[model samples]
Target: MRKKGFTLIELIISMAIIAILAAILVPNISSYIKKANNEKAKDIAAIVFSNSMRSYMKDGKFQREDVLNNINEDLNIKDNEVDVASLYDSEITVDFKVSKLEYEVKIDGEQSRYDFKQK
Candidate 1:
């Protein structure tokens, strides 16, 4: 009678193929996941910076470092100084500064300033 199931050699070949595919795909998948996480970090940083800056303006503490506590804890941001004068004025052209490698965010404007450094 002919065999109905795969032979041992056939099974081994199939497993080998699966392993090869996994080897190639796993790194790519990991890299994509890392990139996604980094993007999420950036978004969180932006929100934190903007909120802190707004709070500073509203509280009349534009030059004070006391604005850091306004951000939520989940963002994992640390205290850092934001130089509003250097960042704003008529010379200022951008609202934010982001560094993916350093995981830093800076918000620049006339009313307030904020610095976020990831930990």
Candidate 2:
């Protein structure tokens, strides 16, 4: 009589297929994860820039330290959750123009940059 369960050769073939599929997928998954992190960093930069502009409008001046503190408070984010400051390489810059305010932030490792102008 034929065996009711998978034979040794059948099991080996199945395991080999699984391993091949995993090898193909693992690198793709890691690249996707890296892209997601970059996007997240960009989003964080936007938030920081917006907050800086808002603080400037409210107080008539840009205060980096104050804006960061307010961001932590308003977002209810603790240091352990995510260090928002660490996402960027340097501080946000605000330039005053005749009719608009320009803000720029550089992402960590110089991977990306965010610029916004408000009139």
Per-model TM-score on C-alpha atoms: 0.59, 0.60
> Residues 4-39, candidate 2, lDDT per residue (tens digit)?
899899999999999999999999998988666556
Candidates' C-alpha lDDT: 0.53, 0.53
lDDT of 1 at 62: 39
Residue 109 in model 1: lDDT: 49
The residue pairs found clashing in candidate 2 are none
- Model 1 residue runs over 4 Å out of place are 62-70, 73-119
Write one digit per residue (lDDT tens) for candidate 1, span 1-119: 88698999999999999999999999999898878877776676666566555655674433333434445333445444222232432112112233434455555545344455554
Q: In angstroms, give how far residue 5 of model 2 lies from its true place.
A: 1.3
In candidate 2, residue 82 scores what lDDT?
A: 32
Clashing pairs in 1: none
Q: Among all windows of ten consecutive residues in candidate 2, which has the lowest summed lDDT?
A: 94-103
